[model samples]
Target: MTRAFLLAATACLISQAAFAHAFLDRASPAVGSEVAGSPPALDLTYTEPVEPLFSTIQVTDASGGRVDQGTPKPLDGGHVLSVALKPLLPGVYTVEWHVTSVDTHKTEGHFTFTVKR
Candidate 1:
C-alpha cells in the first residue's frame, strides 16, 4: 500500500512540473500578424511569472539584423516581458524569446510579424 501511494504521489508531482514552465500566452504585435505601422515596443505575455534577468527577447528584421533595443523588462507582476524596438520599416520581423519561469523551468519560442506600407 505504501509503495502504491508513493508511486501515485510521484506521478502527480511530475505532471504538475510539466505544466509549470512559462509559455507565450500573447504578444503586443501578435504572432503571424500584420500591423499598419511600427510598434514602439514588443510586449510578450507568458503563462506564468518569469525571471526577467534570466530571460532573453530578440527581434530581427528580414535580413536577420537585430532591431530590438534595450533589455527585456518584466512587468504585470512578472507575467509580461517588454522590450523596446528600433524604428521598423515595412517588412517582416522575427521575434525569438527565451524565458525562465520563477520555478526555474525554461521555455522558448519564435514568431513573425509584418509591417504594412
Candidate 2:
C-alpha cells in the first residue's frame, strides 16, 4: 500500500511538471531600456514552447495606454513573441504578455522600456 501511494504521488508531480507553461527568458531592447531610435520590433524569448494562438504581447505608452498598432507575431516556431511599434514619443512603455504553452498551461508577465528623444 505504501509503495502504491508513493507511485501515485510521483505520478502527480511528474504530470504537474509536464504541464508547466513557458516563461520569458529574455526580452530584446531589454526591459527598461532607453533608446534613441525607434525599435523595429519587440522580441520576447521564452523558456519553452509556446502556443501562438493563445500567446500575445502588448506595448503600452507611459500614460498607461496601448500603443502597439497591431497584433504580435510568433518567431522561431513559437518560442518568441514580437510586435512592431509605431513612432513613439520619448517616454516609458510597458510590455504586457500572456502565453499559453503547448501543454495547455498558461503564464503571464510584464516589463517596461523607455524611449529617449
Candidate 3:
C-alpha cells in the first residue's frame, strides 16, 4: 500500500508539471516602462505556444476601468498576442492576460505600464 501511494504521488507531480500553462516570457513596451508617447500596440510573448481561441488580453486604465475596445490577435507563432490600444491619456495602465496552452492547461497574470503626456 505504501508503494502504491508513492507511485500515485509521483504520477500526480509529473502530470502537474506536464500540464502547466505557458508563462509570460516578455512584452514589448515592457511591463513597467514609462513612455513618452502612446504605444501603437501591445505585445506579449509566452514561454510556450498558447491556444489562440482560449487566450485573451485586457487593458485597464489607472482607475481600473477597461480601456481596450477590441479583441486581441494571435501572432503567427501562436505564442504572441497583439492588441491595438486606443489613444491613451497620460496615466498608468494594467494589462491582464489569461492563456491556455495547446495542452489545455490554463494560466493568468498581469503587468503594468505608464504613459507620459
Candidate 4:
C-alpha cells in the first residue's frame, strides 16, 4: 500500500508539471497601483512565454471607453507583453488581458490603476 501511494503521488506531480499557463507575473503600472501621470504603455510579464497572435489586451477608463492602441507586442522574449496607450487624463483605468501560453492554454485577468491628478 505504501509503495502504491508513493507511485500515485509521483504520477500526480509529473502530470501537473506537464501543463503550463501564462499567468501574470508583474506589470508596468502594477496591479492596483496609483501613478502620477499617464504611462505610455502597459507592460505585463507572465510566468511563461505567450503567443502574440492569440493574445488580447484592453485598457479602458472608468467611463468604459478603450484607451489602448494597436496589438500586443511581445517583449522580453515573449514573456512580457506591452501595448501602447493613447494620451490619458487623470482618472481610474482598467486593464483586461487574455493570453495563450506556448502550451496553448488560455489564461485571462484584469486589474485597475489610478492616474493621480
All candidates: CA RMSD (Å)? 2.0, 3.1, 3.5, 2.2
For model 2, how big is the CA root-mean-square deviation? 3.1
State the weakest 10-residue window (summed lDDT) of model 2.
62-71
Pairs in clash, predicted candidate 4: none
* Residues 7-76, model 1: lDDT tens digits: 9999999989878999999999999999999999999999999999999999999999999999999899
| Model 4 Cα RMSD, 1 decimal | 2.2
Lowest summed lDDT over 10 consecutive residues: which window, candidate 4? 13-22
Q: In model 1, which range of ten residues has the least summed lDDT?
A: 15-24
Error of 4 at 75 (Å): 0.4
Q: Of the candidates shown, which would achieve the greatest lDDT relative to the real structure? A: 1
Q: What are the Cα lDDT values of the candidates?
A: 0.97, 0.85, 0.88, 0.95
Candidate ordering by lDDT (highest first)? 1, 4, 3, 2
lDDT of 3: 0.88
Q: Could you tell me the lDDT of residue 104 within candidate 1?
A: 94
* Tens digits of lDDT, candidate 4, 36-72: 9989999999998999999999999999999999999
Any runs in candidate 3 off by more than 4 Å, and if so which? Answer: 1-20
Q: Residue 81 of model 2: what lDDT? A: 81
Which ranges of candidate 2 are over 4 A from the true structure? 1-19
Q: What's the count of clashing pairs in each model shown?
A: 0, 0, 0, 0
lDDT of 4: 0.95
**Total residue pair clashes for candidate 3:** 0
Stretches of candidate 4 off by over 4 Å are 1-15
